[model samples]
Target: MKILKYIKTNVLIYFLIGMFLNSGLSLIKPLLLERLLVIQEDQLTLDMVLSFILYGFCLHLIFYSTMLLANFVSNNLQRHLQLRLKNQLFRKLFLEDAFIDDEKVSIVTQEMELLYDQFFLPLDLIIGKSFILFTTIVFILWQNLWLGLFFVAFSLLRPLPQWLMNSRLNNSGAAFSKNQKNFHLSVGDFFRGADTFYFYGVAREKMSMLEKYNEDYENARWRNEWTNNIVFFFNGPIEFFSQVLPLALGLVMQERGAELTTAGLIAMYIATMNINGPLQSIMYSVSDIQRSGVVRERIFSILEDSSVEYSYHTVDNVSELVLENVSKNIGERILFQNLSLNLSQPSKVLIKGASGTGKSTLLRIIAGKIRPDTGRLYVRTSKGEEFSQFQGNIAYISQHPFFTHGTIRDNLTFGQEFSDKQLLYYLDQVGLTGEIPSILDYHLINNGENISGGQRLRLELVRCLLREKDIVLADEITAALDRENAKRVRQLLSSLPIILVEVAHHIDSEMHYDQMINLKDYR
Candidate 1:
């Protein structure tokens, strides 16, 4: 698995050594107890007593110290695993743009957390406890062969309960995971539309919708817990019986005058408890690991998904964009058919269509966000090299702009270096310099929700200017602006020397355009 690659083998070796020493040292305590119990009261001197106390303290000190370091190592392993998984998920989400939605939000957040808690964390403990259990069994067998063999039989039988319910546990876990994702999706949608519901005085409907989702999530969670409890119920009695059987057999052997001392019998009882402890824990850990399979599959599916195979070619500058016999459809309904357009130089082109004629779809096709159903798009550079794909040299500005949570300067430069003076120049060109007093230092929250819609749109325009894109695909960018601000934006766009393909419902009367394409005619 890819997860194994993140496990630091050198560090893991240290962790394993710690587990071995810790488990081995734990068994030594029972042996020491046996020795102490065998001694009579008259022979126990002060020096012997002090030495026993010192040995006990030092042994525990080392045991706890080893345990602490092992825990730290496990934490480090978890950190490394989560970071790698999240990084891979982030890269895959953007690369596979067609496969994104609200469900992905749940995957990146909740599913990742589940993967750590149920899988990675439990797996570490299981390994350590398994080591301790093995050493305990070995000590028992060395002390008494029949008792050791009897304990091992019970040990093997203990996991049978969990194993029998394995399929049911997995099914309940899967149901819970599905319901969790659905509830998360519903919550996301409710919050996104919160303003609309509040303004329209329909907030009660939102609550009602959430109630249904909450019921499903809670029911699934209850079923999962109930299934796990059944395993626990069966496991409890078996653990008790396993412990009793070893002690009873030791007693029977003692009555028969087998070579067993009182200290040895006492040690046998302690060993039985130790055996039962690890066995019971291992059973639950196995069930936990089984339940985690659903989340593991969800994470691995995204991680192992093959990326779309396409190499993006770059041009220094775009000289022309030509579409021949282009067609697009949504399901069975054709949005546009046999559409053709040619732009051979830097110019403004207006695309106008009725509500369903695919104006925004055409912009997406030109922006390389999606592909047309038929025909080809050729992008030729100034040097006369024609490429069949539009991979670079363009900036797309949609109606709803995208902004990360950061300072205004961070949003504009997008981690690139640019002087404040240059940024202020563009901010002023978009009439935001006077509006934002902090200029570069102004912080934005929740994708600039503190700013007005017009300000967010202007910031997006500034981003395009800073990117120095050769072609700008504007999809109803001015729809949110007032008439005056809209006119200002239109004038600034018209003055630029780069090519602009704008899709708009209304065009200014005095604005100049080199060409216009109407999708209704093409249809």
Candidate 2:
């Protein structure tokens, strides 16, 4: 039943009813018009003619009202479905710790927009055109079996164009979408780093890259347009056949002396013309349906792909973290090998390493952002059992801190329930209390753009303090701070009861640390 659920079910009954009424109205008009012309002298009366006209008008009114209702349902269903899918994508991108390549992420984001459009609009066409096609086929059979066969045979010709257009449109649209993302990304990179370009005197070089990206996009767009135009041009011939073929067939029957009256022949022609409307509708709908299929497939690929699974394993109360025989290799290059370390709670340790010595990689492995191929990460619990866990009792901060758009206080609290007194205490400890003289409600842009780099770093440090995590892993927390502020940060970190494992380039020997692990010595 869940599989059967779709936008069509919401308004399908109303659409079907409208279609039947339209077919009935179409069938009656030709017969009534023919009788009126044939029996103009005596067989037809003004009152009878007036009654038929009124009946036709009423049928049209009902059909139009149902169409309005159907449209409303379709629009509502599309809005709901698009929102649902977008929400799912947002969750997967932001919440799930999946190893997604940057290029793949860009491709998926572009495809998501296409999926939203297809779900909202093309779904209606798919449903509506399918119904029309079905009704047309049934009507044709009922009118005349042999004529229906002929019409069906001619209609099959439309599918050739449909197949050809569908094959090219999907491939071209995907290529166009990919090229468009690259073009936009290239333009954005150029503008975002304009200062760097000026400093290096490479403005002309960047401009050349932009031109190349634009040219690639243009070629892709032209290919897509050419394919679509071919489909459109082919549709014109199909439309002509839908009308002219039926009329020509009626004339042949009359010339053959088949006992067909003039009105009957005209009625048959009208019925045939009615079939053409649905046929054309079907062709357009097929194109849309194919496009939507591509989008749907792309979306599903992301949602269904296997990600690194996290075990729900946890500890009662973590007191220490241990990394045993941990080894990491990126492609053919070894980052770290057989490395072992222990970090005990209520203790401070400094990790001293030069650039490119796997300091950041180790932090990522501990944070559960990246998984090691061969290793066991154990958490020593208060119960005396070393439990292997992925994410718990740890808060790791990167060199570049991410701050949401908000005031200084908002960035520190991070939406947690914290008292103003507690907030002030942490800010005062980090030497940011002097930055804002007034109350802590001053608005700041996202990523703390209004504040200095040192101030933002201090704010992030305070945020980590507020989390009250069991273990803290910081990467160059004092890199941007002045000597005085850096001392204050060092003092604040020394006072925390949580286990602190820091990656630092400049570690003052005077600063008290329980242990100093040198990565260079391990290698």
Candidate 3:
């Protein structure tokens, strides 16, 4: 119903009109023939024939035109739903990142599309076809009572096999959905880390793993396809009966000297053919209904779940951030234990070691990106009112900074309401003034591709400076720069009043810091 709930009463009015037109169109031939044979007492006239022909044409005209309008309305609704769902999922993936695991990317891209196709599409079909079927059945009963009763009895039997195998079919669909997502995620990982695999001489192994995932997906696909085949196999005979028997039995009754007129028998045949498509739709729609039900359940699990809590309290007049006896263990490996530190004033700290020394991880904890396993993280205010944590108060620059798809200025300022003057000033400070050809409006295609690596770092620096947070966490900001520019960046950071935590292997030895954390000695 959540899927159907989107079709507002106003648009639903048009959709219902579409269904009504479809139902009305099914009645045209039957009524026309009945009027000629029975109502006119077999004294059919040229004027009567011509009148019916024109009237039938007009009904078809309205039907097709209303159908077009209904299609446009449904499409607009689908697009709106896609946009709204994408925005919510984007926030979940990027903002509330605590819920992110291996399947996050796959869920955001693949499952979103799945939800659209499997859930909403089937509901749309059901709305259109169900009304047509209901209306046609009513007309059938009005025209020939015995035939109508027989048709209804047979149509009910169409779902017997479907009901029996409902659980098996649903399980098959759900398993395939899971396999498809897992396969995509694995393929994405293989592509993203191709260089790493190549360096390790494990490229072949990665390919084999991808092949395994592909095989798993293929197995699920084949199983689901076979299950569908079995369902349709049962449905095939019933559909054949529904489509053919009404016309057959009506003709048989006429041969047996039934009271049915020649025109009436022809009308009944036309009526049966007209109702067949919608009847088949009603039967086949069960599978789609079940599939969508499963998909809806999956989507609801995500939207209804709020296990990841983000409590960011931006404290006023906060001069010091303290971590008391903090310890963290990632799996079996310990990253930090009893890591107590005090930052009461503007300070410069450089954290550095080998790659696995948890330098970035430590900075992440300070920035509230992760929690310490054993100890408390606190931001002690100057007024002695300590808050739970800090996320917004600290500006972070990652080793590989990322940007959303947008212009240079869009990525630089983020969502901050800043003027052109503020932007240009920060760009100037980071020495990225003439480097960007379009200046503030430079179009950054695919995460700042128009800019060089050094320019990317400078752009990040500009964004950081614009924030003006009390603490700046810079992780390998100077990694992409040459000696001269790197020195300039280091010196610029040291001169700032904000507490700076820099993690770099290529540190400027001449630059002075209030504290130094060489992870080799600290560990």
On lDDT, the leading prediction is: 1
Q: Give each model's whole-structure lDDT.
A: 0.81, 0.69, 0.74
lDDT of 1 by residue, 311-387 (tens): 45567778888889999999998889988888866789999877878999999888776889999988888788888
Q: Where does the lowest 10-residue lDDT sum fall in candidate 2?
A: 1-10
Task: Candidate 2: list runs displaced more than 4 Å.
Answer: 1-50, 95-110, 118-120, 164-171, 255-278, 285-298, 308-316, 390-392, 437-439
Error of 1 at 16 (Å): 4.3
Estimated TM-score for each candidate: 0.89, 0.85, 0.81
Scored by lDDT, model 2 comes in at: 0.69
**Could you tell me which residue pairs clash in candidate 3?**
none
Q: Which RMSD values do the candidates have, in order?
A: 2.9, 4.0, 4.2
The local distance difference test score of model 3 is 0.74
Candidate with best TM-score = 1
Q: What are the per-residue Cα lDDT tens digits for candidate 3 across 144-256?
A: 78876666666656667778899988888777877787798888799989999999999999999999999999998799778878976887788667657766787788789
lDDT of 2 by residue, 1-523 (tens): 2212333564546554544444443344555555555655665778877876886677667666656665665566666655655655565565354434453455356666666554445556556655555655665556566655666566656667867657677888677766776886787688979999989999999999999999999998798768767887886687567556855776787698766567655555565666556666666655554545645665666555556234334456788889898988878767777878787778888888888878888888887767887877878877777866736567777668877777767777767799999988888888778777753787778567777888878777877888677778889987887888888888888888888888887788657888887777655
Model 3 poorest ten-residue lDDT run: 1-10
